[model samples]
Target: MSGLQPLGSVDICLVTMPFVDLCRPSIALGLLKSALKSSPYRVSVSYGNLLFAEKVGVERYGLQKFGRQTRLAGDWVFAQAAFPEHVTDTSDFAQQIAQDIRRLAGLDRDPETLNRLAELVLDLRDQATAFVDEMVESVLAQTPRIVACTSVFQQHTASLALLRKLKERDPELITIIGGANCTGVMGVANIESFPWIDVIFSGEADDQFAPLIDHLMRSGLAGLDAACLEGVITKTSAIQLRDVSGKDLPCAFVSDLVTSPQPDYEDYFTTLRQVSYRDQIVPGIPLESSRGCWWGHKCGCTFCGLNGHNMRYRAKRADQVLNEIRSLRQTYGIERIEFVDNILDMGFFDDLLPRLANEPRKFNIFFETKANLTRTQVGRLKAAGVGWIQPGIEALHDQMLKLMNKGTTNAINLQLLKYACEFGLRVIWHVLYRLPGEEDAWHGESAKLVPLLHHLMPPTNFVPVTVQRFSAYHDDPEKYGLKLQVAPGYLDIYPLDVERIGQLAYFFDSNLDYPSAHDRHDGFLALNKAIRDWKRAFANEDAPPILGMRDEGESIFILDTRACATERRFRLEGIQADVLRCCDPALRSERLAPVLAEHHGRRYTESAIAQAVEALRERRLLVEVSGKLLQLAVPGEIPDLPARSTFPGGIDAPPNLAALIGASAKTAVAA
Candidate 1:
């Protein structure tokens, strides 16, 4: 299957392109194929870019003298590792395209940079054209009646180019494309701009693709006949194939994900074995236990733009999830799985977690869950063979959390971190700063607790939150007091003139220009520096503990364990001990004042308690944001990982964030 197929005929060909997380095969293609495999449908999947990554990529890396296994198993390291460092630093595709257009139109600035960038763009265009030709020819060789490409991330341009080429090679092939990139107008824009993309599906195509395929098989590739398939857009007349987008088709199939068949990863595993360093591929079965985020379905996060118009929440039954997971594990002999759900189904705790916990196999799994998970739930997740989680821990301040519409408090986030550490679960969370309308005081207060969190698995990333295409920020900027920057990075990524890129680009920066680094807008810079310093210390195992609790006779001694502490230890008696214990998660100011009054009638005055809180904040022992307070120290040290050394920079200041988002930030600043 890795090589050219022998002459054969197939019903459909699904392709997953380059730059997707190579460690985890796409759950999209597999799920779609499973859905399409009804009575008369035969489905075939081709991970063309993955195959390219394995074969041609290995050969290229060999010339550079990379190690055998490293070169072979390097797909994840090379492709999915936010390897967009080069794109961000200088050779951003859209920026280059925009430059070329300007120069051609007789407007020029740095002509030399423009000339060099133009050359790079031409080279990439040539490469993409070749890839499209190759993929189309390969799929055509199998004689599939239809070819669909799963589009995500930077795969947009390549997918569009391929759809164009597929039609050029054979108009009868019925070219189609869909993914996060194709949601809403992004799809409409591509179809409106390029008429060759025969059919495009927006939003969740799982419900649309199968029925479309069925209709196409029955009615042939005639225009206006596709009116039955909702969310499927096509030209009105195939004879007059112009840049006219077809009527909007609606999605009918909810396809009860609870009872839907398990994903078919036959091709993924088949392709995995073809990787040169065969033993190096320890691929995980990418599973989806739920469709939409249950939490985000109601009061969605303000900054979250994922799920697009398809924010409706749907989850698989717990039994169905466990059965699917178990079947996948037994079938693949691979215990590691990465759940692709936007959020963990709350119902999983009732059945899936407990069942998986009791199962003999102890599979290693990873999931993303809401941060509001209780300590008991976190522990249950840990017990149930879940080794990793991406808890939605954007901030450790209630105000910041509220600004994001995260619906969870700082105390709850802290509690989740503590539980993750206590249960030995690896946490990957980010800290978003410089949020619009956020007070400078919020970050100033949040910075103090940065050092305290070093005991837990350090934040995997910290950067200013971006305005994504489908998020609440982009949906209605005015409602959230956000003025989005459209004529910038969006220009760099897509080739359309200023007007069109605004409608298509998924990522955007604020158009507000900060003339000086000293602006209040620069508050996040200092906070970012503090967080980076904290991360370095944590990585080196040098960060201090946040809490040290002990009972001596009738008195309790609680000490701030953070490094460089003046009052590392504090002794509390009676009422004071009771007050500190109430800081479990956090106690709001309104509630804290009353509780202290009730507990410490005469011993501690309101002013005295306020003074103590200020003292604690000064020592970085307490995170006092607005009225809520949390003891920042979680119970475990950041677990040292073997991949920690793979980070380009040294322990003093690791460079992942700098390599990934730092360049983008600098680009924004320069813009």
Candidate 2:
């Protein structure tokens, strides 16, 4: 390795393409650099997304649009579906685009307005192309021999366009591509379509990069073979692919996170300083503590299509993880670390949580874990500085959970919400429907439970299941009872044959086993409306703790803070009050009379106690389970969170109190 020649300047320039949040560095590019450290070739990384800053800085596009949530902005850099070339003098294109965007964002728009989106797109294309040219020229000025681009999600179209223009600027400039778009079938599809791209590399390029870099450095542009390296795809002809990406080889995940050098984030920082809106540059250092999902290997959630094909979970030792965290924190001056793991290994509770809690400087971290987490585990995670968690609570109905093969009961999902809320850990999750066996009754049952748990985070979005590649549904569509078609967005983005689009697409529109399930008369429509309102209501922080039981001497008072339900606080006394007191430590309703008679010197008939508890159940104040009765109220002061939604800052700024109290407080209070 030492025999390799020392070269000046960057011989290989890795470009990270766009559409991801600017707030986090690319873990793929970071890992690629770490894996390639053994190679003697001097490679420097570049953030091509920063080049879009040129368009953003010139006031071509408003900063408001780049706020991530904004529907549309002043300038458009990323090219979506093809604009009509025939309508050169079209005046309707810009107007149509504006109107469509306004309608989509729920802004006021007249349906009669004529559309001119095609014309506006031409102007946008010109601006975006100019921006790409300027940046490519600057990179070429460095006389780099090769430029490798990483494309994922929305980055694909933009990367393809840039590489085309870069090659047009100097056709001699070698172009290599990788990332999510370059894995599996999508990689070969892209390589065949885009002539400017010289090669495509699969997800794990550890065994692939060194030889390619050496070949480029030693041989220059001449005599370079298409099949020189593993995981490399090159042109065999005008439209054919010469792929040497040996699918059987070990991937990047096989490299230990514990042993791999901390991802070199210097390129990201350097790019950040050059961008115009440094204010928007809140970068979280990406740390891969593990890869794959332990649960997926057992019975993967069918709706999830994460971690690609690598579903076998592997994790670093606790000490190795801690040392990596310390090294990353010391090197990058940032405490926020986002784990790129598919699922937090169950072992983290044993191996990692205790050690992290003992550290002098606790990290503000985020992880995706199983929704069936215990209250004790949630508490331990918070103590270990896990500020946010995405527990997989897609639905809160036992039947739906079973249909999705989630392995956890709806009761368990609801328990997680209560526990996460009590522990002050921010829970972020979505509720998805449209499973093969899901019924309208299930959603209604979930909506009914929302009121009883207003203290916990509500579902962020209620969407139907999307068919994505590599999911259980995709692996065997008929088994899941679905017939899939390509999404319409891809028609505009790629404009290829429907069969080709279906093969290349990551997302698809699907036909269900029960098409009548989506009928207008279906009960899920009401559930959707209810969940939307619930999501809105839960975003408010100053709302009084809905499920907290307040003790007042002989009487037990409960505040009904459910915004959607028309109910007020409840008061119970005598035997009825004693019935709830037994539930404080949670005793069976059948045993309530004995506990009351033994401890409080109050005796009541079992028949009288049943009637009193039944009355409480009618009011939705008590949760009855089997013979046991658990209090609806979670005992504790509501813990704080970096609350979700449009209001974005940490801990100090919560959603407004007026918003939380909603429109029916005094009315419900009077009831």
Candidate 3:
């Protein structure tokens, strides 16, 4: 919790570079730091991201970090500094990226907007060298014998730039790189491409990092035999580590997450205090209760490549999770906890949520989960202080959901959304399209369905699906009737051959020829427009779209203010009210009829129940998906949930970079 120890007191300095979110620490570095607590080496973490944000202005830094993924703008900017000889000219690169952005984002080619984007890209690209130089000097000041960098997302090029400079400054200083980007073939590619990188760690280095450090301290890099190090990939051992097919051997994962040390985030907090815009930032502590996707283990989503080589599910005990949360809160005096798990452990619903609900102190939590959550489970999540969730609601059509292998139908996805709205939980989700074998009609149907649910939260964005390595589509593109190639943007970012780039690339651009491929454009446009309107409806703080219901003994009152509402209010009684109550958790027509019959002690035919459901659907009170009917109107008063905008220093929107820089300058002058 104290400031970073004096220079020359640190041995292994783990670095987290630019473009990573400054609102949280690098859990990878934090875990490795704690893993080395008992080792002879004195481990320290250098939050280069905080330092770089201070120098370049946080707003501009965020623009690149949270910007369009396909653009790889952050990587391109730092590629200039990292690979100067390769990426010499930017006139063509800038023009190409600008055009790609317009096409992908469906933005009109407005000259001024495009010119401003170009200017920002070039300006940031120009500043990369100086920032990398400053970071190198800062890291060298610590006099660390071994410097390691965690590279994920846009951090790859920046990490390379810093380590390259450090190696140039001190050739004896060991430079190591590892993270999501450096797994399997990507790790081998990095080792082969960058001569400065002395070692590359693939896979989960949780169990291997500390031991590797111990080996280096005792034996150094000379004549080092790394066969015992499970995930270590060095230049000499890189070839030997590959299989007969020349593919790099899969890295071993930690089977038992219980034994892993709780991450040490002291460095993140210490670095945060030194940030010039510290007051503007509300930091959240990142914790992991589980690793790998349990759903993926059974039936992996076709478009997902998040788990890399390891899709086997592993989770710590419920007690371990609770203890970690309490310890982090007590240590940092912060209550916002973000779970970095790919998916919530199903056991947590029965084990962890109940414990958190019973706790005296409440913590705001964010979790990613499946969309099949029942209403009771949703209520439990709300009670457990899980205010935000990414429930993987990727599609709103049954056929589309099947294509993605989501294992949940459109009805279940809608039910989750309705429940989330009713419980005042912020749902972080998006509509993903462009799956192989997708029909144009699916998009049209989704666009039609969007307006009826304006009372619920809109998706964050509508994104075109991209093929990623380790995904079903990428692993067997031919089987899906698609051809995969390196994402075109990578050509502009990395000046490498297509084949070599393919090996290094995580995201791939797919080429599929379907009969309705061209016609699907209009359908996508309509859906995107509908989603945009849904988001706009929530913009006015004074009045938000609302469709809510209150249940009385004899009557149910439904208030409707949604854009698609037919009337201001409606009163349901007798069979209508009973049908609404019966379908609160969603039910098939046959089941609805039986339930309604049991409620009133009278026989109700399926046709009669269907007619009543249709009447409610006409008034936008009920929705039937995949033959199951669900009540759309949320029960009781809807709470005013906190919006993402309310969160301090979120990376979603761009602030004024010049203002941040000017403010920091004034602060330094005052000091």
Candidate 4:
């Protein structure tokens, strides 16, 4: 294009149906620059892909707390409500969300409900399309000689469809697809399935993409025979197609893609005036220090998709990582950033974090890691300004955890929780349910696991598990025999399995097994039973709005609500009633005061606040608190209350209420 030894390659667009906006663009940029070194083309790299928040509700409209799962549920419901004929797992999730939105909005076929639903659906589709279109146009404007796309989840389908339209307009454009979802699942997605797609590549895209782009730019067209591509599934005829292997594909090409000329972040994002997220765009370039995970433990837990139980870690040079961070900051104006790594192993942290902290950039990073990290590592994370850490804890029950191949024990999980709690770091423990073994554990032995989780609740959590073919049980069902049954919907085997098997297994696709009446009946019964048990025990209870001490701790009180000690007992002789008030808004002063008063006599003093807090603390009825501000802490059951004795200001006047005496007077005097 300009200022380079050009082989006539004008632009290269690297795309992914993104799971997160971090690192991919930067990583792609780095790789693209490396690829250009071998080419005679004037190379320019631009990234655009459909970036999705697991929950569409929050990403599209601004319901920040609305989780990806909840949004998925809402979307599933909307999709079903809109097109029930295409029922799938997504539909069921959507139905649940629809029910919830119905309840939350209090709309029963009313105009308000319909309008809200309509607006939400439109907003979802529009925002999703807009983002997809924006990235596509941005790339198209670069006049790329090559186009590559990747998908990680189902949402990418919409974005891929848009890309196909672009392809239809310009068939000569070289198109390649690769990512977690695309590489593994779609071998050679039927070219007809996506008419705009010229070639669907899988496995690792780094080595494959550069070579293909070079070939396409040099020859103006490249041949795609099944053997040349490791994993390509292409339609050769109206009735038949070919499936090729992609196992031999080279590993990701990790190198500096952009050279001497640095990026201008303001210019880049500013080009798209409406950046997707409205929150403060803490300008931090996303980059990964490594590829794959290092948790070599054989049993990573059954539900884990991270690394597919194959832990591979290739660390980037520490100095290079530090240099990149500094470069992105100085050149691109990035300050706060997130390091999107599977897990920043403790060793990496010990070396990298201290160096990073010394580098003079105040950055805020986000990461998801295993629970086996040490307290020291967590402390490092907090010190590094990591505001969010998604730890994969999966389940509290050992059996369930084993079933998921989560190698760590509940004890280890709890220890991590304790450290995070003590350190006051915001953490979200990712949990899962409905694993294959859950049914066996559900009857009795496993029931205990739920309460165990009570001890380690986090501010954010989730529990979801879907049956899959490659899980230990699914992989070797002959051992379990009749005890293990495959669900119909799970036929869409993960690409990891396809890599092993070479051909698509009928057993993995959801539609195949459920074809017959009896098979479908048995499979569905198993799923439904799991769902029922999960709902009864976990359901929305594990969801967030993290509980605090103020949430009623029943069992101790006469009415089985929050326990209340009588005010008479609490009132030391001649103590004023107004001195004990502690302004904990979490407490329902009106309702709880009478209960507290019935327990502690009408008395006023700072000691009364201390006594009430102390009493509740002793009984374990209150949540763990810091200073005067209280948080609901205890997970279950309040202790027994001592028999009540009558006191003044109604039999149920709070002992601390007396402490309130002249509290307003003090406030007035201060004013």
CA lDDT of every candidate: 0.64, 0.65, 0.82, 0.44
Best by TM-score: 3
lDDT of 1 at 449: 64
**Model 2 lDDT per residue over 1-671, tens place:** 11112224776778775445566677777867776688776677766665564353422232223221212222123443112222232234345454544444344344322222222334555556565666576567557778888877656766776677778888888898887767666666766767788877766664456667778778764555543555566665313443333233212345454555567787777666666665644667777777778889788988777766777777888888888889888987888878877789888898799899998988888888998687678888998988788888888676787788888866567667777767777877888887876777767766666666665687776767877777887777898678887655565445466776665667776786332644653457667776767766776655743665567878777666765333676677887777776764345666787788898888888789889888777766676532357556655566666544211112112212232223224434576
Q: What digit string (tens of lDDT, one per residue) describes model 3 on residues 77-192?
A: 78878888884558666665556554554556766445555565676778887889977877888788999999998788999999999999999999999998888888887888
RMSD of each: 8.6, 8.7, 3.9, 16.3
Candidate 3 regions exceeding 4 Å error are 1-8, 95-110, 242-248, 513-520, 605-607, 645-653, 657-671
Better of 2 and 3 by TM-score: 3
Give the Å shift of residue 368 in candidate 1: 1.8
Q: Give the higher-lDDT candidate: 2 or 3.
A: 3
TM-scores of all predicted structures: 0.78, 0.80, 0.93, 0.59
Residue 87 lDDT (model 2): 27
For model 4, how does the per-residue alpha-carbon lDDT over 1-671 read when each residue is reduced to its tens digit? Answer: 11112223356655544333422244444444555556676555433321333224223332211323314322222232222234344334333443445554344755434344434444454455455555555556667767766554433454355466567657778776555544433334324445566666544455555566665676644354533544443344212433322332222333332222222233234322333432322234556666566664444444344433235666666676667778766665545455667776566687877776665555655667788777678778767656556777765556666666667765566556655654555455644544443543332333323332333333233334543433444445454332333322222212123233323221232222222445434433443343344434432433412222222222221111122222212221222122122222233333344545565454334555566656654433333211122222322332221112210000111112112223423544576
Tens digits of per-residue lDDT for model 1, 585-619: 67875566677667545346677667766666665
In angstroms, give how far residue 464 of model 1 lies from its true place.
Answer: 2.5
Instruction: List the lowest-lDDT window of 10 residues for candidate 4.
Output: 646-655
